[model samples]
Target: MTPLTGGVASDIASLKVGDARYCVKFALPKLKVAADWRAPRHRNAAEYAWLEVAARVVPESAVRLYGRSDSAHGFVMEFVTGAETYLWKTALLEGQPAKGEARAVGDMVGRIHAASAKPNFDRSFFWNRDDFRALRIEPYLSFTAEQHRHLAPQLHDLADMLYDSTQVLVHGDVSPKNILIRHGRPIILDAECATMGDASFDPSFCLNHLILKAVHLPAQRTALYDEVAQFWRAYAPHVSWEDASDLEARICRLLPALMLARVDGKSPVEYLGTPRREQVRKLALPLIGNPPATLSDFVQTLTSRLKELDAWQR
Candidate 1:
């Protein structure tokens, strides 16, 4: 039999076993994607536990958890397969898949978030000194003096506020990259750093993460944000603009720090050259400051600037 080729992210290894193909996912602390810690480690057992619950709740949208083994950081599990979601969307945007498939991706997240609203388990993390220590303080100490001084203060305030927010299971991370367009719908994967905290945490991550990559390409950012935001808006209708307002406030405040967290956060992604990554990192320089007077003011200013720069990118 021929080796089974993958149709998703290359973070995993796969093989064809006789008449069957096994999809395996690998995760290590050293891979250094942002937000996880080194100590007790991300409830590897707990993550698996939550995976079980997530499977039960969002079966259609959740990846099947088969088995696991420990790695330098966490553990590996069976790979979720169908079609690589990020590639699917990108291909669709480039005019490959059907347009409806793109729209369905948005709705899929909304539904997932809805189910996550009442998580079967406890997964919230307090944005306290511990989280900061594991994520920012530790990773950042590796940077030069200027970068540390620049990032530390902002992370402090953002962590402080994040510590005081309401909890929810918002997929923790929801970039287009992590999504798989299996069977023509969105199936979210990578729940390792999945946390239960701050209702805005996940969606805010979705909004800022993959979408921010498009920031340097404002038209792309706007187009993507429109699709993404519409998905969230329609999916979580009960989630009022006021609710969004509050979360958006927190997201804006944390934007600069979050950018730094990418490079310094525990599970940081490799800084492969992408126009989005390079420019956003550069533009983030002046934004992650000490505490701003009010969240609203901070949000308004940052968003206006985000819009202006993104538009200029076009």
Candidate 2:
């Protein structure tokens, strides 16, 4: 068995049984981070349930589940290799921001949300908001709020709003690191934070990664921006459960707070240097206080700030 990296809340490994290879995952009670972060191991079961629902909704975009072991707090699933698929995060960091793959991801997420939002859809097995708060809300928003005292009220409000709102099932961690691309299709992984919560969190979490990548790789800013646009375009049409404008407004408010969370929260993105970290703070602070009314306005403001920073450096 070979251990997999890039995840914090679980122990993931590639395993082989006879001629067939599979990926096995075990949830950790204590997250592997610099902070004293811990959560319940039952989230492993929640993740498995999420995969089952996602596969039912979008078969092509979910990893094929093999079996799960509740006693061991682990599950087994399909093991895709680099020969068959590439990690989207690797490709984006290497300057290959494939807009097609981004759109595919957006479409898959939208379908899942739309399908699950139906009144008859069963969600009893996914009432795992405590796990969500332990993994996402507390660490990302609340922890960051603790550090940034001035933004405490706004950040806490965002956290409460996210925790209280329940529209559909959310694939909590939608960043590029959790996505694998094969033939322009995106297979999403890591649904430990999956719960019936604010739908905006998924899209906002994704777009935040693209914005962060643009910060880390300034040369690829335009390409990443286009990729973000494509992703939003593909997702916006699926906002049938609520007003698209209202959802976008929530996303705009949450996105910048999420931006700050990545920089100041428990699990900071490892690639950003100190200067770039400050850059994120400068860009996110004002937006959190007074977010744009629309996503386009937010992107335009972000683009202008990046350009201004470039000129200042020169």
Candidate 3:
């Protein structure tokens, strides 16, 4: 058995069964990290159920499930390997630019959310928000608020706004680490945080990674911004909201809050230095206090603010 790294939510190991290989995933009641974070064991069941639903919607982007073990609270799925396939985050970290690739991933996510939004789509199993709170809110948002006492009220309000919405399906953790690129498209993994909630969460969550990577690798800032723009361009057309402007506004508002969370939250990015972390805090505080009017506006404001702060030099 080979243990996989880069994930803290589950116990994942690779195994070879006969001539084929599979990935076994087990959801623990608490994060393996040194924290009080805990969630129900059945969240693994929710992930398995989501995979089954996602496969039917976008088989190309879904990882195939092999089986499950109730006693272990785990499941087995196809192991994506070979020279042609690699983790998207690994590729990005190695300086491989993702221009068109980001748009394809956005299109795929948009299609999944769009198809699942159909009137007859059954979303009964994903209605639970306990896992979302334990895994996302408490650790990422609420915990971050605790670190910055002054921002507690706004952060709490934002957390409430997230939980109050249940309009579209949300993939709570859309980080690059969970995406594997095979051929020309992205195959999404780790659906334990999947739920029926605001569709904006998925895109905003993904965008947060792009922004953070730009922060980590200052030289790639322009390329990363282009990718974010490309992703929004490809995905926005598929959103079927009555008030597109309002939803975009919400996305803009959430982006800074999430960006701040990555630096101050329970799971801060490992690559960031002390100076970079401070840069993130400085950039986020103002944006959270005054949200931008549009995604483009947010991007522009972020770029200008970072420039004014000399974030790249730091």
In the order shown, the candidates' Cα RMSDs to the true structure are 6.0, 1.1, 1.5
Give the runs in model 1 whose Cα sits over 4 Å from its true position: 1-11, 26-29, 32-42, 69-79, 82-151, 163-166, 216-221, 238-242, 263-278, 281-314
Q: List runs of model 3 lying over 4 Å from the truth.
A: 311-314
Q: 1-314 in candidate 3: lDDT tens per residue?
A: 89988788899999997898999999978787766778888888778887887788777777879888878899999998877788888877777867477898888888878877889888887886777888887888899899888888888988888787777777788778998888777888888887887777888899989888887787889998888989888888888854667878888888888989988888888888998888888888988889987888888987888887774565
The C-alpha lDDT values of all candidates are 0.50, 0.91, 0.83
Candidate 3: what lDDT?
0.83
Number of colliding residue pairs in each model: 11, 0, 0
User: Which stretch of 10 consecutive residues in model 2 shows the poorest summed lDDT?
Assistant: 96-105
Query: lDDT tens string, model 2, 82-152?
Result: 66589999999999646587889889999999988999989998888888899999999999999999999
Q: Give the best candidate by lDDT.
A: 2
Q: Give TM per candidate.
A: 0.65, 0.98, 0.96
Error of 2 at 302 (Å): 0.9
Task: Report the candidate with higher lDDT, 2 versus 3.
Answer: 2
- Give the TM-score comparing model 1 with the true structure, all chains together: 0.65
Clashing pairs in 3: none
Candidate 1 lDDT at 278 equals 54
